[model samples]
Target: MEGGKRGDEAGPSSEKLGELSEKLNEVCHVGEDEEDEDEDHRSNGVAAGFVPGPLVSLKEQIEKDKDDDSLRRWKQKLLGCLESDSDGQMEPEVKFHSISIVSDDFGEINTPLPVDENQIGRVLFTLKEGSEYRLKLTFSVLHNIVSGLTYSNTVWKGGLQVDQSKGMLGTFAPNREPYEHTLEEETTPSGVLARGLYSARLKFEDDDKRCYMELKYSFEIKRQS
Candidate 1:
């Protein structure tokens, strides 16, 4: 009976050892599975602290699309300014009358337009004495990077001169119906005016019942011939 009881206790110890070995095998297999998964991710260029290559390409494409849209908008604005008129139609014909120069003693002179700044001359203009065009003239002096609005009138016949040295900045007059007038210089000196490319800007506007037509002309200053 003593030998049999010892054998039975030994049998329980052996069974317990077999169960522990099975549990250890299961733990090792689970750890191996996790390691394999980590290796697969690294091989595909994706890691815990990395960005994917495809995501960078998508960002560049989005920036390119934004630039293309901005360029299209700028083109549309420029076309509107050039092609569109008051009634959203193309502009029509514009005709401007000729302007000349004259002096009191010499009458109508043949001098070139835009005489020298200090040349002491006059500009003669002739228009329909009483017309319904409501034509108006404006004289502008541009010199030394400055532009000054000198005179404005609607006379039928007149002359004009702009001189900064003699204090005769700019003046106009009505001499005769389709005649000449002299633009005199001032004896007193006001101040020194800058000298450079100067111009006379003329603007004309005529309105019909539907839409209006506006025209602009610029005459530059030139040396005496």
Candidate 2:
């Protein structure tokens, strides 16, 4: 009771107690912050507000983050046909007209012509086994590829009969009227445009074993597809 009554008169000791209390409060606050920091590190592998590790400048990283493979781009193809003649000893430039595109087993419009029904000559086309595509293709052209091959003596007196297997002598022979082709002003496709391909072929009889009636084409089907 006596000490409590004198406490009011003794002010220096009270001030010391207050200073000690302030120090203790500061220490408690520091301890709590350290515990919070440790808890944050355990949960997130980093201090809540602290930035860890060295800061990296973007200039040092530069273009390294981009993929190198992204540089390639899609490209389109050109389609059409041109012909050359090789009957005689010297090769001759052939002119072609009435080009056509044919297909078989066309399951869809956007896909390539089926294997069996792929690009070939003749309106009569064959489809592959289990093929769901359409057949028969034709296109217009100004002239035949081997234009000069149908000169005077080439036609028989008995009227021209084209050997379908040999392109020139067959129905398309120049002297034959039944299968004669008329020149069209357009280089555009007229008959079949399966998917998106165009084709033209030339057949001819040759004494040279090295050459046979062959296919000539420059049709563009979407290769990117």
Candidate 3:
């Protein structure tokens, strides 16, 4: 009788263990699904045909065709007021000042760069659902020319990537004044299902695939109150 009782007790314990194992498997599958989604997103980006070129200094380029007056004049026009002697610096450097969201209803909301660590994961701003908006980035370039400066943004909701976008901001030469580039307009997703907090990563890179800055932040989409 004691042996039978022990077996009965073991039965409940075995059932409990089975339940726990199933729960663990579900959690692991969820994690794997998220990883697969991220991998697919990366694959799509790689297929976009962005190939980084070899890095060459502006001074070396200018010296290559010293005898070609027409080429020299064209280079001068392309580089603006940049003096040829100013190529003393080695690699290009970019410092972001601020990012602003412009909208017809909300006007403009600006956020200064180098966000505090404490605020990194916090919601920086809220947007009205279905509202059209544009992002304006203000930054300064120093040292050498930044070739093929590009901006990319990826957004996620509930551990699932919802959107991704990339655009070229063009090459820039060192300048005393900051340059402002406004992105193409975008409309926020509408409806009750779209109203929620979303996380996003913004990245800035050059032709050499050198990342200048990366920022992770959150925002909320709400119905206009």
TM agreement with the true structure for every prediction:
0.18, 0.17, 0.71
Model 1 C-alpha lDDT per residue in residues 1-225, reported as the tens digit of each score: 122223322332343323321211111111112122242244332345544221112112222223333322432332222212223222222222223333232344243323345643233232121211112222221110111112221111123334211111121111112212233321211222221222232222211111111222222222222
- CA-lDDT, candidates in order: 0.24, 0.24, 0.69
Q: Residue-pair clashes per candidate, as listed? A: 0, 18, 0
Q: Model 2: how far is 86 from its true place, Å?
A: 22
lDDT of 2: 0.24
What's the lDDT for candidate 3? 0.69
Q: In model 3, which regions exceed 4 Å deviation?
A: 1-54, 84-87
Per-residue C-alpha lDDT of model 2 across residues 137-202, encoded as one tens digit per residue: 222212222121211111111233211111222112111122323221122222232223333333
lDDT by residue for model 3 (1-225), tens: 122223322332343324221211111111112223342354424424666444456565545444445444545555554664566566678999998989887799899998889888778778999888898999998766776777777899999889887777877767778999999898899999799999998887665556788889998899977
Clash tally for model 1? 0
Candidate 2 at residue 181, lDDT? 35
Candidate 1's TM-score reads 0.18
